[model samples]
Target: MGLESAVSLYDQSTRGRAGERRAPGAGARPLRPHAAGDRSVGFAEVRDFHVEVARRADPALALVPLLVGGDPSKRGKVIAASADLRSRGLVPGMGMVEALDRAAEARWVPTDMRRAREQSGLLRAAVRREVGAVEIEGLAGFYLCAPADREEALAVARRLEARVAEQMGLPLRVGVAPARFAASLVAEDAGRSGARVVVAEDFEQYLLAQPIDRLPGAGPKTAARLAELGATDIPSLRRLGLDRLEVLLGNHGRSLWLLACGQDPKPLRVRRHPTTLSREESFAGDERDPGELGAVLVRLSERLEQALQRDGLRAGRIALRLTYADERTVTRSHSFDAPVSAVRELAVAARALLDRIDLGPDSVRRAGLVLRGLEISGAEDRQLDLF
Candidate 1:
């Protein structure tokens, strides 16, 4: 089968399984599963996806220090860099001028998104050929949920790594773990397209040995704050416990604490949208009124509905996030019984998620909505209603 057809087929099948495919009606609820640690989840991350594509186009650029972005004259940040360039302190988001200063002979090239997408689709197809359901993350990450036993997961990862090397001429670093977070972390080990199968029992120590800053969702800002608090590693954060961490960083800390102990239950979501869409509104001042936030949700949902309409897509899963006045953010998500594209349905889901949180007197400074698990509209009648 063609790459597009294979990816589209896997994408359609996963939409049903990832977010319960059911007619929207009474007693219908989307089931988000929490698999045990032994249920192998795989992470296949394409190493140097953009740079590798560029290298393939020009063979000589293989061993050279390369940066993907805009030319020196045109203003653009470094989007991706080769191992040699990154070793020289060139990171994504760095200015082109700074990069040039660091490496005078660096070959700066603009990333070809078209080629990236094409190569990514082929990689997804390769993984889907072995595993039934596949989730596309960004341009290079393909996650397979519950790919059977641990041995099967490892075998699939090895096969995928070799397949990409032979077929696409792109290297894919593979990791198999009991959960999504750990698997993704294991794949981050510095090297080209290596494979690491994290044992479920030994995962906690493996997780602790890694720096605290490596925790997913804990960005540079969060890491800096954690460092300031003297919790500079996973073990330190685990020592703080969930209740204390909650006091320190609000409810977001709860998830981080779980990561410290290797208990992250975050599921590997199916890529429902061609591109993940997020809409955020930051107030000039802290705003705590639920009614006011509900109004904002309506506007955001209207915007989300327009994007879905423009793309001829529907979102089966939605995530709600709020940043409080103290800068501590909390997020929650729900998968719908069926894909939703209407403003009213989106707003309803948004508010329902908002209601699940306790703001107390802490005013919310920001609110956002992220829609995922997109599928082509008119492909299936999810609900009995029409927009």
Candidate 2:
């Protein structure tokens, strides 16, 4: 998908709104901008761009890109409410009550991180299946084209994007470069463009003039600090020298310094298989009821089962992570004597673990399920051992 196309889709809400909103268990309704033509960029475009840039720079250099799926607003209600609230100076990460007070007409719905992550997983699967090799960065995105030549590499990226559109109903924006920071910046730019390739040379020049806030790791607070120091853009910040940057930004400062210089030491490693398959959700409000939480867990386990089945994999171990109201976290896990793919079995194990934790009502914020000890079905014909 070209950048212009992606933006057009984002702007094209179901009924003319900024996005389509679907409440849990509610029928899909037309709200605003309707789904249009495929809005994703071609992976080939990204791969070629990265190859071209790498040839111009050091051939051994790698490209690491990042993407935030369902960013700005994870849901339609959230987007609508955020906009209504933002007009009155209310922003994200703010107290819900304060936001409502600011915009009495606003309507806000909680975020569904689980849905977002599932969407992300679909995209990631496409990347892995189509691309030559990939290294998943985190829950949301991954890195690609490791020391690959221009032609073969670009082909892989193009295939990846195509597969993602075919498998998932989400559009992807891609960037490519010899450096991770540069790749991320360019991908975002391309995502916003009507074109696919944002030429690496042009991307570098573009990076120099852009504000620090545009950089991957620079948050609002860090941007403010940089602004106070007379370093507004990447180029200006680059002149601050590593020692001075380390003093001001500490570890983050040093990392920023490297990125500003168009270098990232993070290497890409190919995984023959995923280390784990997990689903996590962060509630908009704290909940105390185990039943309610268990219901969510059931939903998550179902999703995980679908994911694993889609990939033809099974889990040999299960793990649960729960974060309480006090910001304290706990984790528990159990190994299965035999691989399991059934959602009921997974949920049963998960519920047992949940029962052991003390998550008072109004204090539990997030919960996650991670499946490890993966074994490819039929790859090994060992007898099932139930311990």
**On a 0 to 1 TM-score scale, where does candidate 2 land against the true structure?**
0.56
Candidate lDDT scores, in order, read 0.76, 0.59
Local accuracy of candidate 1 as per-residue lDDT tens digits, 26-76: 132322223354476778888778898899989999888999987667778
Clashing pairs in 1: 272-373, 272-374, 273-374
Q: What is the lDDT of residue 360 in candidate 1?
A: 93
* TM-score of every model versus the real structure: 0.61, 0.56
Tens-digit lDDT string for candidate 2 (249-324): 5678777777676556454465645878888887888878889889989988998898887666889999999888
Number of clashes found in candidate 1: 3
Model 2: lDDT to the true structure:
0.59
